[model samples]
Target: MSSAFEVRGGNRLQGEIVPQGAKNEALQIISAVMLTPEKVTISNIPDIVDVNLLIELLGDAGVRINRVSRDVCEFQADNIDLDYLQGPEFKKKSGRLRGSVMIAGPLLARFGKAFIPKPGGDKIGRRRLDTHIIGFERLGAKFIYDSDDNFFRLETNGLKGTYMLLDEPSVTGTANILMAAVMAEGTTTIYNAACEPYLQQLCRMLTRMGAKIQGIGSNMLIIEGVKYLGGCEHTMLPDMIEIGSFIGLAAMTQSEITIKNAGVEHLGIIPEKFRQLGINLEIRGNDIYIPSQETYEIQTFLDGSILTVSDHPWPGFTPDLLSIVLVVATQAKGSVMIHQKMFESRLFFVDKLIDMGAQIVLCDPHRAVVIGLGRQHALRGITMSSPDIRAGVSLLIAALSAEGKSTIQNIDQIDRGYQYIDERLRKLGADIRRV
Candidate 1:
């Protein structure tokens, strides 16, 4: 794979599509396998570029991993190779994916020291690791910053659980602290913890392995530090971001689709946001039903006022779904405001959509006003480069709805999260090809 994708437009996707396992959850859980040297089995792992790179990272670190089947793998981290951490290739792999930063806590917990490069992900905004560093500092880890080399070294005499409050609820930060806290010496109480489903799953897996944790679903977490964690079997949840993406896809192309085993319980306040956009979603058992509705209108607030869909911490609308919401709003009947509070630069993709004939007002860096031109204006196909993973997929969705075949380069950004996207969308009758 050349780390880019050529997307062909002018196809209406039509078929049943079940999303792959959650990439966000998979990364953390896979790293947690290093908490102990025993073999741990994880199921429902997504086959994606980032995951493949992570597997290679694990192998480089001397962790033994075996693929029992397509959806199952066993990992053993008994022998870690420290020599592998000194090269540019290692940092390159880690720097390309945000999940790479997550390994620091586990590696530090087990080895008492870890070396990590400055983490990287989408170029949309300044995704800070200060929250992560602060969390580790609460656990008594010492940090060294090398601005010249762009590397970070974390070491600690011993980890002790203390009363820590995150300045902001960063998802990866919570996971890092949870991993380090499990092996710490005393009780650690984390207030304002990010309780996203991925973090929740990581906490559950830790508990199953004999780590005592309380307040699993709230902003506060209590972890009783233990000596060692045992091996256990765990599975990653379905990707809610994918579910939201598919919802946008079905609406944009006017297609009927069903999302299976969507883990709706984890989608707090997500479906409600989509409903305001006049997109009807039906919940039947564990599956989601989206019928082909011709005219999707923007619904107003309870006071008959214009609505604003903003991102917040967990239990609030997710920052990941903001891109999809912005794209889907292009075809909606009325106007709505999108406030991307977490990442300042995430709203930049509106320019690409505006070039495609969507009416979007970028109100500063943190907000945008989307006055949907309805389905009357056909977005003409144009050559556009993907900016970020979520925005890349959102642009792909727009390209699918454009008048002619469109070309979107830099699809490697899209591939980081979505697994076999071309294949899965092809099954849904989407006319997308990779060259």
Candidate 2:
């Protein structure tokens, strides 16, 4: 069923909200359960569409699943039906989810063979699987592509440890390679690996399951292969992207909002970047409190130049929150440049903002200059369609602050990442309805 959100704007929201579990981390961690046949208990799983679909796919493959609660589950892949990987049903289900590709590594490592269909996700840009395939080939896996059926087959007699330097620090690629390397013959050293907190969490969970990994939170990793892994329990971190979105939501709506248990320590440079945009936010232990305000100013650089926000690797600003930052800037008090360095199509949603009365210039596919309207002339509502996950929430934020009623279509894209967003927004006094 298709859905849309009809939002009546100009309402100030005030309340406390808790972020859901990390979506990116959950994808990697859930896929890792395939590495062992023992029962793996995972907690704090987000009740979102994508995660639920992945869990359903695992069940269809014969993994024993125990739904301990809505947010907790135990998975035992003792009797997986490997033949299901070649069926049309598996291809249909896996093709809808990009995270499905992560399963290939564990399947190849344990069973010496794996099948992966062409994966799909956000249409933000070209997310290639070359990094994953190239890493597998380096570890003694033979790769074959069936172009007619749009499938990838990987087989190996036995994977041997090797030294590999990734062309780019792809997060999912690094996780895929790490899962495969944990059970190989000798020793594997991966240079230029992604060191995101999500990757660190995966490493910690794998370590608890008897995987020998060195350098938990660094770019270089060394892993000594083991014969088998045991089952372990894992708790996911709070969604940093959702926390960032809440911060932006409060700023744009001029509302007082408190984010409970935001996992502040893990949010690298996110709050600081919002602070650079002159959004007033305070950290109280692990929680973040954003007070309602009339106006905020964008800070200029020390040399009295326009401040430019760009995405980089971890310990830097995350690319996922750039859309929220761009939307928040539309109502601020100065001009700034948003440089979406990672994905070219990310900034395309600025056209929708421009139609809503935001003073933005689409400089190119990768950059945009937003001149703050200062709330002197309020944005008027209009019907728009969400292009991707980040952009979808960004449009929701814009709609909540606009002058009148607005309709946002394609909310499935939004539901893919955020959990019960419309219901949560209503708790904070937002006039939004799902139709």
Candidate 3:
């Protein structure tokens, strides 16, 4: 069924909503589960398309899956069919979700070989797999990209510990290599590794499962290979990106909403970045309480230059939030520049916001200059298609603030990341329906 959101704007939402499990964390943790033969139970899994598809892909490979609850599941990968990787259905399933490639790390670590199709997810930009394969090759694994079959083949009689300096702190790449390095013999050192909350949680869980890892929150990691790993239960943190989106939604709609269990400590620099846009986000305990506001003025830099919100590595602003920030800036009291340094095509969605009466200048592919309307002018509803997951939610926020009904199509992109977003918003008094 094709799904679209019918949003009736100009309603002030009010309620408390909890964030779902982090999708990025879930993907890496699920891939790591394939490393051991014992049962690995995980809770707080999001009921979204991408995660569900990855679960299905794992099941197709002969892993025993039990749905303990809507947000809980257990997996036992003791009897995986290695030959399944070469099958057509495997390729078809793996190609649709990018997380499928992460399984190669575990397969290579435990089974001595892996064959994975060139995976796919969002078309945000050129997300390379070089770091993952390079780390593997450095650890005595042989890798070959077969252009003829459009798949990656990896084999290793035994993986040995080695020192690797990643070219960049690629999140998934770092996770893939980390999973593989844990069981490799000797001590493995990875410098310039990604230390996102996702990786930190994964490493913590791996430690509970008996893997020796040093450096929890830093870019440098040391892993002493373990002979075996046992089963352990892990809980994912509430999605920080979703919490940021909700704050933007609350501000845009002038709603008083409390975001519960928001994992505030793990949300580094996100709240501060939102504060730069003059949003009043109060951290009451672990919850984010956003009071209704008519107009929040954007803050200028210390030098009186235009405020610039750009994406950087961990502990800095994220590129994923740039789309939401751009949409929320449309109603602010001042001008701001949004620079998405990671992906070139991410800022192109500003044209759709422009059509809805936003004062925005799309300066090339990577930058956008947004002049605030300061709530003086209301946006009129317009039909638009969602290009990606983050953009899809940004469009939803824009529609909620518009004066009339808006239909946002291609919302499957949104569903792939956010779990039951419409239902959750409705609980917050939003006038949204899925059609």
The candidate maximizing lDDT is 2
lDDT of 3 by residue, 1-435 (tens): 678999999999999999999999999999888999999999999889989998999999999999999899999999999888778889888989988988988888898898777757786888888898899999999988889879989999999999999999999998999999999999999999989998999999999999999998899999999989999999999998999999999999999999999999999999998899999989999999999998899999999999999999897887889999999999999999999998978987888899999999988899999999999998889999998999999999999999999999999999999998999999888899999
Please give the RMSD of candidate 1 to the true structure: 1.6
TM-score of each: 0.96, 0.99, 0.99
Candidate 1: Cα lDDT at 50: 82
lDDT of 1 at 231: 87
For candidate 1, the lDDT comes to: 0.87
Clashing pairs in 1: 5-411
Q: Rank the candidates by lDDT, best first.
A: 2, 3, 1
Per-candidate local distance difference test: 0.87, 0.95, 0.92
Those runs of model 3 whose alpha carbons end farther than 4 Å from true positions after fitting are none
Q: Which pairs in model 2 have colliding backbones?
A: none
Candidate that scores best on TM-score: 2
Q: For candidate 1, lDDT tens digit of each residue in 87-193?
A: 67787777776778888889878777877788777787787889989888878899999897788989998898899999988888889888988999999999999
